[model samples]
Target: MPSAFLLIGIPGIENGATWTSLVFCVLYVLAILGNSALLYIIKTEESLHTPMFFFLSLLALNDLAFCSSTVPKTLGIFWMNGGLIDATSCLTQMFFVHCLSVIESGILTAMAYDRFVAICSPLRYSSVLTYSLLRKIALAILLRAIALIFPIPLLVRQLQYCGDNIVLHTYCDHMAVVNVACGDKRVDNVYGLVMSLFVTGFDLLFIGLSYSMILQAIFKMPTKDARQKAVGTCGSHISIIFIAYFSAIFSFLTYRFGQKTIPHSVHILSSNMFILFLPFWNPLVYGVKTKKIRQRVQRILFYNQSTFPPSRH
Candidate 1:
């Protein structure tokens, strides 16, 4: 087995590694703080203990896991010039990164279903997404992600890497690692394509369908106020889904098909953005858009003020 792999951080901007490191560091900090705060607020707030908030909490955890999978090592290379990763370590990182991504996609699908139930059958929403059912959904998402991704490291381990072991991206990814292997990687590529199509692609399709039904239901509402309220509830989720999937799909397609035409820097930056942007912004989007979360976050941040409001007596 190859002992270690080198990560070639941004090709052309090699001299600007410090600047790149600083920017990523800031984003990582924001992601960590934002997700942590969201989790804390969700866990502590009694009124936000429903299925929707429960799923949002899971999303916050996923965002944390997803960003943590790669950013630290990426920062290690950019900040401290530690770029080499052992074969086993590289495989571990790739496994978690891909697994968390798949899990997040599944969670997004579940969230879409939650919205569907809420808007389509308000009376049945609680019964449909009870705590027990939510637990099962979460467990199924985890199991499916693990089962689908379990083959990746095993398949990758069988490859021969006689060529330069330099990964041209910021992190250790399946494609980036596979591209370096000297052996026939057609199976690996095919498996990846199949997984993407069956898993993430299916989730995106279902989310789209869910939203279509949601819109149809909202339009049928008798009053504009009711329609706006329904739309408002889904707005944050829609924003997050768009940011997450659009960036992810864009990066995936660009890596697979735009290597020749797209600028190297653009590809590298977009790939990083795909992994980092959603995690960094998801909490902010929900915290600002969801009134309950925003209020709880405010209370958490300014406990003293909330504890003792200005004297009106």
Candidate 2:
């Protein structure tokens, strides 16, 4: 049934050739390959098994699952008039999308805490961020995400979608799907927003606050290299986080408060951009910021060079 579900929309209305469809295809490939590679690098490199990279692995996994669920369906709809997505498939997408989203936000907050202790309380960093603690945190994250999102889609199942299931966007997104409900979605929206704010929005605030304190701590520390290293480790994360949450907050606010003037194209683009670009940026920015990944990449290149032994000059 999931495979048989139809995505009725503008695409269903008898039209063809959307440039964005191609873009979504490219996005799907990048999301899969990019996140897969990140996971590979982390798994192969034992040194990367720290709490920081552990969370990185979780983030990568979530990205892989999250992107896989939506992009392919969207791409199919783009190429064909309308892709069939059964109600089961739609709810599944809704569940995984929100689940991954919450996990990503939670992991980011945990990483910020990791940074805080690493910088603020270096001597106690290892003890504070023990494997058991991280495992607990991860379990907490998973449980929280599951708890928050599972019901919304189940609630959706109860709604009577008698007609007009034509969603304008590529995939079965939350607001898009919920809008078709015959009953009031106000409770659903409010409840979901509360969870999102606590899980994602508030988490972002905490991460930022942690970084602010870290900045202050760095300034107080003597030695340029220390200051540079501390700040540099965070700059890439800060950049990626800024892009991710800015797009997210923009999309959320526009969906909620900025709907009047927000063009459909703008609304759609902003939402997809975060998931599309942010996932790719996570591994990339971390590779740049962390010396270990750069070293591993260099070694990989060198190993390939040795294997082929470049043509004699």
Candidate 3:
């Protein structure tokens, strides 16, 4: 039983279609297993013990969280008629969403910094990103995510809603919930916009700059193979980054910039885009590009079999 109730167009607790519910079930299954596999791969592979992989594993963890925060509820809503979530459950969903959003933004920023250090000061890469230092940086990202997100949830919890409980979206969101409040919402809206633009916008600029330096480094390299490999490593990251940012930007625009004429379904679509695209793409992106991850996964599987032999006679 969820504490928060959604005020969606389906009216009170209407049961969604069977196929839609099934689709969500399938997606949730894949999302959990995919991210779990990524965690295992990074942990098992000693060779994959690099700054890039470190950031990636964190990103994977966040993706798992990002999906976990909403997918379960969304599926629940679809599976049950008149899916009724309690107020506290709604708040929890919003809190986790904010937390994961903060973390993903921080992880992207750290990844850009990692690329900057790797490209701009190649000589100091090892010393700058030593294992202990990596742990601290990761902890910093986690702390920053929690710190940035805590305020939004706190603010939301303070408000009193006066019966406009039909949340247009399937899951709880900061703005969506805040919009239902009888209290003044302008301040919350402003805070939301500032938070959104600052974190995502800032990360995008730094990522762009990182690629600029990386491109220069590639051109100055003496051999084609070196350049090719460098570009290869960057390709998947660039693709994933583009997709993640695009979905985020689209959703942000709809919530902050778009007019009422845009309709509820459009908003739902944008939110869905943000929810599904990154989780599905991110694991594939890093898992495919990173060599150590592959090797480690292989070892994890091999060792698992070795340790637990089949019951054959």
Q: Highest lDDT, which number?
A: 1
Compared with the true structure, the alpha-carbon lDDT of candidate 2 equals: 0.77
Tens digits of per-residue lDDT for model 3 on 1-313?
Answer: 2245763532232444565556656766777787888888778667777888888888888888887787766666665544566788777788888778778877877887787788667899999989898889889878877777778877877777776676767777888888778887777888888888888877888888888888888899898897788788778777877787887887788776684756666676567657765777788777777776666667777888899967998
- On the 0 to 100 scale, the lDDT of residue 26 in model 3 is 77
Please give the distance, in angstroms, between residue 96's alpha carbon in candidate 2 and its true position after superposition.
Answer: 0.8
lDDT of all predictions: 0.88, 0.77, 0.76
Q: Candidate 2, which segments miss by more than 4 Å at Cα? A: 1-18, 309-313
lDDT of 2 by residue, 22-76 (tens): 6667767777787787788889999988888888888888888777767766666
lDDT per residue as tens, model 1, 1-313: 5788898777887778789888888998999999999888888889999999899899989989898888888888777778888888989988998899999899989999999999999999988898999999999999999999989999999988886789887788889899999889999999988988798678988999999999999999999999999999999899888888887888788888898998877888887877788889988888898999878867766877778758988
lDDT of 3 at 41: 70
lDDT of 3 at 59: 88
Per-residue error at 309 for model 1, in Å? 14
Model 2 clash count equals 5
Cα RMSD for candidates in order: 2.6, 2.8, 3.6
Q: Give the TM-score of candidate 3.
A: 0.87
